[model samples]
Target: MNEQEKSDGIKRVIPARYNRLMTDPLLREIVSGLDGVAEALAAKQQANVLFDELGTPPPDYAREAAGFIGSGKVDKDWIGRVAKDELAKLVRAEQRKHVSDLINGCLTQLDSIAEYSVDDVLAELDTRLQELVQPLYAAGEKLTGVDTPTDAIRRGLTEEWRLFADAAIEYAKIRAAQKIAVSVAPEEFKDRGQSAACEDPHANSSVIANIAEVWESWNTPPQAELAWSDNDEGDRVARWVRPRVEAPWPVQTDEFLLWCIRNDAELRVPDLGQM
Candidate 1:
């Protein structure tokens, strides 16, 4: 690229990088605990018992006649009945323990992949991004306009946040990095020798440019439902079109726009445009 292009590219960054500021160490722990409990419940074992009748007793009429004579002795066993009840209780207890172990296993295994994966990249990106972004929330209210606290501080934070986010998005798009035990490159790559090429600043710069372009392009279409009429020589026609926004950009807008953009599909189309 030309020197001017390269210079401009070097100056761009993405907003997602600032999101790392919101990272909470305790959040993962809580999720892991919940997962452990869910797994424990899911892995429970069950116990059952079956009763067998040794033989059928004689018919009521036959037994009644024989009861008066009393020629034979009645024999029954209590040991078998007692043993069955005890076995069932013991089996149930064992099953409960087995289920508990399963839950513990799930808790331990939550999001702990040995190699690089989408989740791993996403988690890193989320945590890092939040860490960089959370500082912007200086007031009690949610983030609205860019003007807040001190302008110089805000600008510096914004720049760094964009840079980090841009780098992360570019890294994720590569896709090849999602391999076994692959170590992601550092944020600022340093050339070690003649064998390696210089870091591609344009890679991130291009992504940021695209993001800005799409945002501006999408914004060009007014979201408000406008009411206007066309007058023909002998007829009058009136119509209105309701606007809608779909995924991807909507996600980005909601995340970065402080929910100022439509969320939960609830919008106010006032007759006079008042809140």
Candidate 2:
């Protein structure tokens, strides 16, 4: 890293790293990858419930993994039902919270069955490998020389973690921290993070609402603001005759999120849950 000098004339603290991350390409990729991973995991969980109903274990999460990348979409209809199935899986003594969630209409725990979770699969693979190797060890064979399944999985995860950490550190070093969070999300992961509207009003109305609220909080249109100044009372003084800002940065952000929410579908599910 090149040694950079700070200006000696200033000592103001700012969220330099956070500010830079807001527009960092690598950060965007990692964040998108994370959302994709999370949704896949949720899908895998839903698939497991289906497999349990079929009295079988999913083979390498084939059904879930394929569907997630294929025509997988969040089935709002089955959201409650799938969650109920999962809740039923718990032992009689351990389902208190989940049961409450179901009855209260908070299906937040049960949803989106389309993709598979890498961590879940890796963990399961490690478990199965241990089950296979345990017997061999019982017969006096030394487990050595080759990377065990668990070791291999851990090794891969560790490397990925290192890479992610490195990217974040590099970003922080080069950029400044700023905001707590942003609403930006990649396609297939609309409105998955902080509060932000989708680009399309139909995709996420809350996005429009959010942007509108911010813009009109002062009674101005979404794409522009009225001119104003402070009065003797230390409050904003109206300046109606000033020019308006057409299509500000926030509007651009709204468009970005809306496009993502609209196109970020895995598979369109019927709105039959209303039934």
Candidate 3:
């Protein structure tokens, strides 16, 4: 199939698989729980629920206390202070439990998808995972009194998703390489025969080595920038090299570059300059 067809196929298959995976019981439960938590926070119902759980004082006792205070003409400041302190304790306890449950549920859901192979399905899964957890993190931050709980949840979610993103990118490179390798025949190059004497024997080797060096230093894929310059012979040639940024290298450095040159016309390699 042509390149467009291959891309289209991947797009279609990925979403289908993503939908199927979301149907899994564990994932659905986590998603539902997160949604419920978000709704509760949005509607400002958590405080109301907490108040209900604290329960009302008996009517007879409240009436008798009010009468006694009225008869004594005593100041109500001490009673108000005590009630405020008690309410604070109850609010904190309830919020902590709520946030803890949401975080635990998210982590559990992530564990279920931890074994998924890095493919198109993973790309979608990572996106959905982020969507499911981020709002919950926000809710946690809003509900919890201290930053520690929310910070811990954010770190946990980020670390887990990062692993999936890394694996997905690596898998994509492998699949792209396999596709290009199959499309281009080795025999096609064989007929071109030996290199011309005037051509730089070390051109491809030097370029390949430089590319490898860049890859080795990278912590992520470099955003390769393309530029063109005239050689001494006055012929304009293309060069697509990594941007001078601190990031990781792409997987299979040499193969990925070669595949780009072969498959992407715009990224075709230009004649090499003298080393």
Candidate 4:
């Protein structure tokens, strides 16, 4: 795909302004801070869910908490870690489906990015990088040490990492665009997109997908897929990397803000003289 076509693909997935935010330093920082805010706010909003669990205790918690107390580290360190751990699980449970769908959607896009005429995207790609990559324009620069995206990508292979499998840059305008379609509305995919978990909360676990749904959840690059993830459940699970949304509040917040800045930016009317 040529540059103009590449640019068009990005426009379909997100607003052009999001691209600017990713490149520009100041706006990027502000977006990062807002992501932090989102995580804290989501936690505050869901705090009651955690407290509600107090009436019932898990066997592990009973043992751990008791051990914690006996160990003499009973101050803020003990209770704080326990509480934080529990909260992380809660967030993961609610967001698992969200994360899954993001994976499915991005994969669907990646599947046929070349033929994607306001309809297609890339095929099975890096999870977090996939989220940022429809263009994979930014990260490739230093890794390949080439100026243009095409050359850098071609060079990326000779290096250590593995992201691009030579997907077309565009069939339309050429520019960087988000690969993962999280904030994107599903209708945009014309039903070719993966179904979000929310739409079918009770899906059968035994359906036996003839094609295996990936464990990576499309969160990490291929080389990093070997990494483990907790699903924010605090237990190590298979071939997936931890998602940004499930990170500690500060980190989660930064990621969300950056995503918003890129995909769903609002008009930032400056305070100007009023400030």
Candidate 5:
């Protein structure tokens, strides 16, 4: 792709302005805090559900109470313990409201973020996405430097590393769907632009194949004819690298992927013009 085309591709995945916005510390803090709030709320809900099921007393207490009423047998201590348990459960139930309030606080924070520019949130998203791919990008750079480039070894090694980058890029996009409101799709190779000729020293057949596989895996299903590679080639490579999402809130998958691809492209191939 030409510089403009490459840039456009990057923008399509992650708009430059928005990608920058993601880096804002304030935005990231809000997202992290909100996710924590959500988790606390979920915990409270679990406790409430348990309280509702267990009721005012444990089963043993209820049975004893029944026996006392039926057979003139009374155990005050058992009743007291049951009452204590029931009170404990009620306290937990009451705490559920507190959880609800905390969640509301998070929603309020999210609403506050809504007032901010799309660019800022997007920038944060981009940063997180880059984090996800960093391990693979570093690995790819490292391996490319260390490996002896034979046709077989070249394909096996480089492509495998690239796959890590690709998978990380793809999965980040998929994950972004839950955070942002926008719809973003992973970029695909609709048509092969150029074949890596046998004489091309820089091109590895494995890399080329995995590139196609990367595109296909995003678009296709696990049961579909095209899926992630599972060969000795596949085993040596990871399907996806983890990208850190700045925001805890889930975003639209496509936009997330776009940002990830744009951010990761340079790392994967330094020569943007040629890529």
Candidate 6:
């Protein structure tokens, strides 16, 4: 078929394939489950059971159940029923946990799939394949003393086939890397002060100073007068302060510094020492 004919055929086939995909039950389930709608429904059913037992509507069930549990009017039969129901809940929670884990795995796979763009992959393939075949085309022209339509077509096909083989090999490598990335925890890949340092290499000293300042501020003891206060004794004094140097940066600077300290990066705040 000619190029236009082939293009037209692809256009028609793609829409039909898309329609079929959209109508697929599995795909519909996946799309709906992306927002945890199914999990919400299951939770709602559990809530309904609790509502019925409490003899109250869903909205008022929580208060009613709390009162029922706290009241001193409980008998042996009530205690046994509650215990039985609690055991049933524990069993159901264990089963749901297994299903939740499986769903999470599927969601992670979908995220990875979504990360790749078909157009981008196709473009890269085309570019790399062209680069791979250029030398072959040049060699063919040199051997023939002059380029011809037949020579060009043969060289193109040779390059295309070689590209296909190379693509398969590259695809395997990509899959391996993706698997490794998935297997590794995100926190494991996190660098200490590297992100802050990389954000502005020219202002490394300022960045380090700011990070140290924030860290010290977080761990510093409250003033003597403030120490006696209740608010200062809690999270009030422990609240994170964003580093001045990394202010314009998107990430949480204090958290990044903490990660750096935890990972034991070479970062040091002159007077502050190791951290």
Candidate 6 lDDT over 1-275, as tens digits, reads 01122321211112221222225343333333344435544564564454334331113234545676789554557556666766776665555444444433443443433233222322333344335334433333333322333443565544533433454354333323222222222343212333342344312331243544434332233333322223744743433433433432224332232233333322322211111
lDDT (Cα, tens digit) per residue for candidate 4, span 29-113: 3333432334433553354344334323222456766876688765557567668767876765555434433433333333222
1-275: candidate 2 lDDT, tens digit per residue: 01223342212223232223336454433323443435544554564464334442213333554575677664555546555655554542233333322322211211111112223322332343334323333221122222333443454544423332343343232212111122111233433322222232223222232444333332333343467888999998775553433332223332232222233321111111110
Rank candidates by TM-score, best first.
5, 6, 1, 3, 4, 2
Give per-residue CA lDDT, model 1, range 115-198, as digits (tens): 113234434434543453343334213323433324325655555334434544533433222111122223222221111111
What is the alpha-carbon RMSD of candidate 1 to the true structure?
Answer: 23.7
Model 5 scores a TM of 0.26
Best by lDDT: 5
**Candidates 2 and 4 compared by TM-score, better number:** 4
What's the CA error at residue 34 for candidate 5, in Å?
11
Name the lDDT of candidate 6. Answer: 0.36
lDDT of each: 0.32, 0.32, 0.37, 0.32, 0.39, 0.36
**What are the runs in model 1 whose C-alpha is more than 4 Å off?**
1-81, 111-275
Give a tens-digit lDDT track for model 3, residues 1-275: 11122321211112232233345543333333432334533443443455346543323335556776779865567467557756776775566455444533433333333223223232343344334333333333333332232443565644433433454454344334322222222233321321222132222322232433433332343567888999999999999976544223224433233232332212111111211
Provide the clashing-pair count of each candidate structure: 16, 25, 5, 33, 31, 1
Off by over 4 Å in 5: 1-61, 78-90, 107-117, 123-181, 184-275
lDDT of 5 by residue, 90-162 (tens): 7855554454444344444434444343334344544554565556544454453333334325556655454
- Candidate 6 residues lying further than 4 Å off, grouped into runs, are 1-73, 116-275
TM-score of each: 0.22, 0.15, 0.21, 0.18, 0.26, 0.22
True-structure RMSD, every candidate: 23.7, 29.1, 25.3, 25.8, 19.0, 24.2
